[model samples]
Target: MDHSIRLQIEEREAASLAPYATLSRETKGRFRPEEECPIRGAFQRDRDRIIHCKSFRRLKHKTQVFLAPTGDHYRTRLTHVLEVSQIARTISVALRLNGHLTEAIALGHDLGHTPFGHAGEAVLDELYPQGFRHYDQSLRVVNILEKKGEGLNLTVEVLDGIAKHSKGRREILPEDLSELPATMEGRVVRIADIIAYVNHDLDDAVRAGILSESQIPSHLQKLFGPTHSGRIGAMVHDLVVQTLKNGGEILAMTPNLLEGIAELRSFLYENVYETNRVHDDFIKAKKVLRELYEYFINKDDHWEKVIDYDETTPREQMVCDFIAGMTDRYALDLYTNIFLPKPWSVM
Candidate 1:
């Protein structure tokens, strides 16, 4: 009811959080400074902003692993972000870190991902001059694309976490911490991203009949767990226990646990992602995005109609933004509308 609730929350955080936890009150602040909210702390405000933004909403139709999966239970990008948020918050709460910041970062981390998952991403990278990384596009979304070029103006901490969240094929906890987010809460989200995807993607793969439970190496099954829930629980528990044991100095996984996850990831790549079962869809998705990219880039009138802001932005960058913002259905529809022949109608 009171406007000063933010201060009360800040006080509670200062008293309860670990020394390493990022304090919302002391955020590096937004790119464009403004008056503090009456009731919301900075990170809380950021979380709310991301939840309400357009890009966040578009995540529902974006691909996590499968392209246009007919199965209702498959994990879409939105579900993936929610799961990442849930897992990251759990770890943050367990470690006495900043949960709100972690959630904000987790939710916003994939806002820039292209439709049709990494296949669309690969096509964009190949076509664009400077190349496209969804992490950077996500930062661009929050900083320049959302709010019609006004941007989200989120705090530097949120921006940093979103920017650095991608681990690609790299190790979960690299020796080089410099490239990781500066805050421990941010780092928590980074590791949580990996945990969420590896487990869930495998689950989706199994559900799609792409892989069977027995196909997962027995050693890995033993190391992580026999079930999806069991593996996630094991990974989350290990991360929280390790971080707390180290006094929140570093967000970590036991070397054995890390190796188990890494091995599982390799298995997914070799068996599911690279196999023709997935690649057929991936190849089609790539062609769809590639054709769309070329059409928008070469057709000036169509490009002008699609992009409505800032004439000075590079054509390639604008094309990337347009494509990256599209959902799986939207991309398919646009491609069909532009390329497919419609039935003739008599007046």
Candidate 2:
């Protein structure tokens, strides 16, 4: 391949042309041939903006499985996003797709996840009678939360993919998927999300002593192969080969592959999520969150600093949002102080 084209293979085509892509499609401008390419430099800037955002940084303190402040090996949401980005970029490169776009989508995919993984999400969802979802919250983060007024103003493609990345099937419309700028790249990220979580969640479960390698059923082991690492390697390899062969179409894991992953998920749910080990912590989290919610709702002065909204906004949401944005240890400390009334003497 010529150096220009080889570089294209190495870097995402979109990154170079992101700035042009940001221009309205109807807008007219004269530029060099390369400037008018499908991918634009603005997309790269947008991805970079997301990476540097405070919310993105806070992902390091958020949970993937266990609550924050646990052991170091436990997967934080930030690490999980990086893993997904690695997997998606590998797939993108193997298939001669835009690695930058895929990686950008992967990194931004989980920006809306709550502080405590699914547990904190569940609490927020329950608190919202109208229903709350991380995907929407993620969009909110990029569109509103990043700055005081306008957001990073990312390209439509990145924004749209982040908004509908979750395959809820019901939440996304066909038009939404059709209108995406880099459909194949988005699909790579979508599948990568599942791939990263399933494999790593199992790894975390095993390390926490909630599951054993032998606990993986015999039938599953034979079909999907042994151990979490082995399964992840096989799955990623299989997907890469199949995607390259099939022109970048996402290759859904076979029934056996699906079953194996499900078994692992089920084991974690039963052994880790449902057990008293988790519930004990959850009970405390619930109490602390509720108390903090009540505290912030009643106090207008403190709410002003944490939120952009006026005092008229409901306290429950403000408190939840503030708590949701906190790093793991910060939330825990806040909870302890408010509900347990811990005294902190200021120097």
Please report, in order, the local distance difference test score of every candidate based on alpha carbons.
0.91, 0.66
Q: Write the per-residue lDDT of candidate 2 for residues 87-161, one digit (tens) a residue.
A: 888766766565556766778877877777767777777775555688777876776666763555666667666
For each candidate in turn, the TM-score is 0.97, 0.79
Q: What's the count of clashing pairs in each model shown? A: 0, 8
Show model 1 residue runs off by greater than 4 Å: 302-307
Give the candidate number with the greatest TM-score. Answer: 1
Off by over 4 Å in 2: 1-40, 167-182, 304-307, 310-317, 342-347
Model 2 pairs whose backbones collide: 17-40, 17-41, 18-40, 18-41, 18-42, 18-43, 19-41, 19-42
Candidate 1 accuracy as TM-score: 0.97
What lDDT would candidate 2 get against the real structure? 0.66
lDDT of 1 by residue, 1-347 (tens): 46678888899999999888899888989878898998889999899999999999999999998998778999999999999999999999998889999999999999999999999999999999998999999998998888887888899999999999998899789879997999888898898998998999999999999999999999999998799999999999998888778777887778899898898889989998999989999999999999998998888574433336666778888888999999999999999999999999999
The alpha-carbon deviation from the true structure for residue 337 of candidate 2, after best TM-score superposition, in angstroms, is 2.8
